[model samples]
Target chain A: MHINMKIATKYIVVAILLVGFTSCQKNSRPNYQYMPNMYEPIGYEAYQESDAFANGVEAQLPAEGSIPRGNFMPYEIEDTNEGYELAKASLTNPLDSTQVDFVRGKELYDVYCGICHGNKGNGQGKLVQREKILGVPSYDDAGRAITTGSIYHVIYYGKNTMGSYANQLNEEERWQVTAYVEKLKAELEK
Target chain B: MKHVIYRNLTSRILSLGFIILLTVSTSLSAQEGDVAKGKSLFNANCAACHKLNKPMTGPALANVEQRLIEEEGLDREWINNWIRNSSALIKSGDAYANKIYNEWNQVAMNAFPQLSDQDITDILAYTAAPPPAPVVVDAGADAVVQEPGISNDLILGALAVLFALLALALVLVKRTLNRFAEAKGIDTVIEEKRTPIWKAFIQNQFLVLVTAIFFLLASGYFVYGYFMQVGIDQGYEPVQPIHYSHRIHAGDNAIDCKYCHSSARVSKHSGIPSLNICMNCHKAIGEVAAETQQEGLKEYGVDYNAEIQKLYEAVGWDGTGYTGETQPVKWIRIHNLPDFAYFNHSQHVSVAGLECQTCHGPVEEMEIMYQHSPLTMGWCINCHRETNVKVKDNGYYTKIHEQLSKKYGVEQLTAAQMGGLECGKCHY
Candidate 1:
């Protein structure tokens, strides 16, 4: 009976110990690190500490390590006039593979540029035909060898009679229209 | 025999004690109230006028319990009375009640006579409860927290160690009891028991077939789970360089979620609020108590305490303070579904008029923004199946509802009926 009591007491003690351990762990909550102001360090560290930080900071700031993709096509005014001349000469076929893109390009061109540049690319645009504007060149006119860059530039930063179309077309849409224009030039040459 | 009996009894008791401890601990941890249901109630009723911490049209509710005890002479009775009918209490010449009534420009606190004592108790409990920990958004510390997908491996290792320790402890205890029995000259039965059916089968001719079948079944399940979870990032908390808190801005301050996530009602993405948006608030609100008081001022001009000043730095605003040199806030993207997923915030937010909390969890409550939704195709489909589309008087959905009702029965056509559950709805 004494041995059984001793065993019972031992078991009770073990149970007590387990309860004690678990109870002690009850109040131990996981420490969660709360960062209330993360943007603060990013701003100062990005500007003051980094080599790329130039003083004139403004809204719509470009992301760090972001470079403009695609070819570097300068939109210089003098080059634009010469570029359009060249596009009228050598650049004929659309560079992109997709036919749907070309079709979309044609639709967009009719909406935006058809009034000034004409439906047939024969320089007899609506404005010129109406005698409201002149000096629109035909696509087959020799002497100018327009690269894709000049045509894109002229379309983006408007030349002569044309206004700036940067607002109307996104980068991809601009590229698509550029492809279609080349197709029109090729068709005209044929 | 005596020693053997004693050893057996001790081991049994110890094991039973351990099990009890585990159960008690598990139960204690699992004493969580339904936060989701609590949130819905809070937003529907309290969110329009009161905030958790900051002063809105009314007083901040961070320590309303303490205020009631210290300031107001009444406790539960007073709160219930005020919620039930504040005007009636004010008429009875309660000084504190009259003062609050006048302070709120005589705008009567809406009488929620329907709210039971239990419901009010839960709300008060939530208000009195300490706020959850803030989300750490320091870009520098992010690298340390997420050392390129190491958490999974760490968890696996810890589990392995835990199991090994348990096995070792069991073996040591068994050996010790055996030694004690031997010392007392107890003749222990050394004969092996009959092999269990499962153990016998493992050594039988069926081994090859069972192993193959088991492996094939396991692999099939694993692959299915993997494919199902392809784009889902349920708790994806990316390591952002900045520790921005949505809880502070949205929950505590009661700032509208749309004020920061302006694109949600208009664009494809709920675009991360730019540095300019941060400037709208943070330009003036610069200091937090813990960061400023504890950390001391770091070398960076970006004040840790002054959240707004950080916005200024991001947008290049000199505090004199407006030389339009703005720097954009480079927020690390957290919830990125693949490009193919066609999630439009306007469709759900503006058209359906769903709250941001429906998909993003309680964003205002989240200290660090995490991908709260599982974002899985299955999860999306499940929600679409379960959730009844809000199709009342919305011009966009009204026409569709009529057409859908003509085809299907008028049992409140769900978003799924309007092609919301189609793979094309979410995934292109």
Candidate 2:
């Protein structure tokens, strides 16, 4: 009887364990309902390609290889009066702003021009006033009416005592300083 | 027969109790969702369009549940519906839906119909939960505010308590049954006394040798791990001199992250903006709030306060003003990796196209910047191992993909395969 009781107890324990494990495994997943029609209907018909007629007359299409107008230009500089004029007119502003360009011009002037042309742009520059350098012209001199082109050219390929600034000042930078020098000339003349 | 009946009853009852305990514990564990998985999902899906505390394409998702509940009359069902198909709801003349659509400039929200409801729920829960209050970065303050939400430590504590109570009950039942058996003059088979671990070890020569070997192996492994992790500061938070809030700048005002860290895409260093850059806006911006005193300037409206005056002092800009003496703003550096670690911000921000917050954490929510990533070699390698290289429609990767496919015979190449996990890539 005791042996039978022991076997019965063991069976009961095992059954309980099996029940527990199975019950725990019984789809504990939270029920989720997926509704396909909840969102907007997507249209695929708009993407299809359609040709209307299969008649004998073919469409006259442009040749596959044709060069369009105004698409080509040589990337070289020519040294002539006409070329220089075109270059001068074509030369774009290197700095975006007048303020920035002016600031840059002032900085450049201080570095290069201030020794020859005074800070105040008067004839009495440090070199001229100190008598270290001579033949410096006052911007208000009677004979000269400097054009923008002349000023640009003088800055590009310097005249008389001045050397060529082609290497020192880039094309656009020379023009900017020329603008500033013109401002100084006007200030001195005023 | 009586004795048999008694034994069977006792066993059944014991088993039932064990089963009940196990069921309860399992159910409790199921209630808490995985936060790490939620974080990854959030980064992948939501981070591009939305920030936690800042406005992007959508409104800031910080405390999103509360906002939805109060503002939109939304429950969990409504949120799930909106995430799946917002345009459909808008078309159906939902008043709130139309308002949100118009507010966001009619930009179509991406449909996430594939995401399970449980996943959406977990994401919402993460959004609602306030981040752990920042650690008192200063060594002077030892008070660290634990992160808000169901902490693992708390869960473990509760489980421990429950198990302890169950153990006590079991002991009590055993004692009562022993007493009953004794009273009935039953022949109880006494259980053999358990051998003490030390005693057992001393008795068995083989066991002693095995134990020694195990100890040596464990210690060696632990030492190796410790050495590997020495300089890695995964969660390093350093105190800043000033409480400059990225939340205010990047979040509230919607300032572009690149505006301040401009060199992020263009240069090796995500260069700290010079004081001149700050002055560009700050010169006109002045004090954000009237609460702070206006520094530097003497006239109440015209003069700058002491703090702004410091900026003037740095750049040598006298407030008289524009005396042309400008000084640089000396901002303290926050995110510093080792010299050997070659992390190019441009490569990550521009080329790979990672969000700043991936490594920086939720910078928009931070009052002061701190190093969020441990920036360890392992952390980097692990990320490279897991993250797939973004190759779709990128011209740079077009040639690379062809080569990779030929070598691996796979359509996709992971970041690790693309030399991201190379020691030289991160180091040197």
Candidate 3:
């Protein structure tokens, strides 16, 4: 019986030791790298931190008067009431009828705008339905009849509660979404 | 007969009086507006810009009529006109209207020309309604819930104590037996000792060889496992600066992955969303819902609202607008490939049209994000070897795909057949 007790005590000690060793492998920290130098980049990576810049971040805004490469057109409309009105009245879509791809437009719209402005553009979005956001006007709202130009302007400059989606969607993509919004608005009106 | 006629006439007059009283009371209530109807109206119309307690795009509208009457000396007529058409009111050179328009950065309020006087009354009633009481965490309920866990340990302890008592009793009984035997002058039996089990086992050459071989194999297996997982961080879960719950955003809200990771559709990297993107929704949502806050505290041991406050501080939003002071969040990158690897997010996410969850592994369900896949070269190659190339709707590559399939003599072409296995494709 004494020998059996000794064996049992030894087994318990072994079990405790195993638990301790396994518990030491915490998931909160990263695993040990064989060679960190090879894994880490020497050049400045996206969102890297560095002391070279004034802000100490690798990402920087474009210099003043710098133009992006590729087919780009600068928007002259200022972010003001007058600017909004002007854009709403005059800023027609540059893309001709043939260039409008409804499928791609729908895809982009669903990702960005459909969260707040319902996919059907009736203002009953997920956030609104969940009571997180409210008072999103429907596309077919007659009081503020949204034209294609106004849609693009609103997307670019972001009216009232909405934030500017210019960073997320490019000028061409913005036009695409504008076209889709018009389509949704027409459907809502029907 | 005359007395009966007088009694009937008196009863009829009382019934007429009661009908008049009911009509008056109902009319008074209609003018006051139903609180339930007002709440729905407020949420649907005024809620986007005007919150009851907080300043949003518009100012807080709690008891707005009384506050306006006292502070701005504006009446119900002025509010009615403003609600119908604020820009018109401003154009008409109304002093308070112009002041408010300028104060709110001239963001024109949408004209609710369709709203009747009754609708306005209902909305005003909603704004005037008293705020709901704060939810109190019930300590008694918490204690009740905790009882079962404590009882489990208590039960274990009780069993242990019972076994110890049994052991002690047996020991005492044995001592008594020995003492009795001694008192009676009787001998206790003793067994002659032989070679111990270990010594006897060591003497058996075949058994010793087999045990040694078994130990060697076991050790080798363990060593191989340890070495194999040296650089593969499959289950790496690091603590972030702010506790962002993807479960709440993606799973509960059902927001698409591409909503925040917008660049993944066009760019090489699935970039972390900027603070502006967070502000898109969080500007209105300063704090989480009460139930969500409770859930975070009870389940995850986190105050979700405090994390939102951290985000606001980082973004430098002083409740209403940007303060022009921003700090970039230092997010720890997970699932990073080595410097030599060349992975383009747009290629797989957009062109190939693969769901983000295919690689991310149900990111919506994760409370704290972790590396779900091993992300090893073998893992990547194995997927490439099995997954068929998405060739449908690719008119540009239809001829090439057909030719390739014909060359391979297969009905469907795997990504490997489309040069996905080329070392230069990923390495260079």
Leading candidate by DockQ = 3
lDDT of 1 at A183: 73
Winning candidate number (TM-score): 3
lDDT of 1 at B39: 49
- Which candidate number maximizes lDDT? 3
DockQ of all candidate complexes: 0.01, 0.01, 0.67
Quote the lDDT for B341 in model 2. Answer: 60
* Per-residue lDDT over B31-67 for candidate 1, one digit per residue giving the tens place of the 0 to 100 score: 3434455544554456445667765446677768667
Candidate scoring better on lDDT of 2 and 3: 3
- Over the stretch B115-164, how does candidate 2's per-residue lDDT look in tens digits? 68778766766676668684444332212223322476788889999999
Residues forming the 10-long window of minimal summed lDDT in candidate 2 chain A = A39-48
Candidate 1, superposed: residue stretches over 4 Å from native: A1-190, B1-203, B207-212, B290-309, B323-326, B396-400, B421-428
Between which residue pairs do clashes occur in model 3? none
lDDT values for all models = 0.63, 0.61, 0.89
Native-referenced TM-scores of chain A, all candidate models: 0.50, 0.48, 0.88
Q: What lDDT score goes with residue A166 in model 3?
A: 94
- Give TM per candidate: 0.38, 0.34, 0.89
Give the residue spans of candidate 2 off by over 4 A. A1-190, B1-229, B239-243, B290-309, B318-320, B324-330
Compared with the true structure, the alpha-carbon lDDT of candidate 3 equals 0.89
Error of 2 at B114 (Å): 54
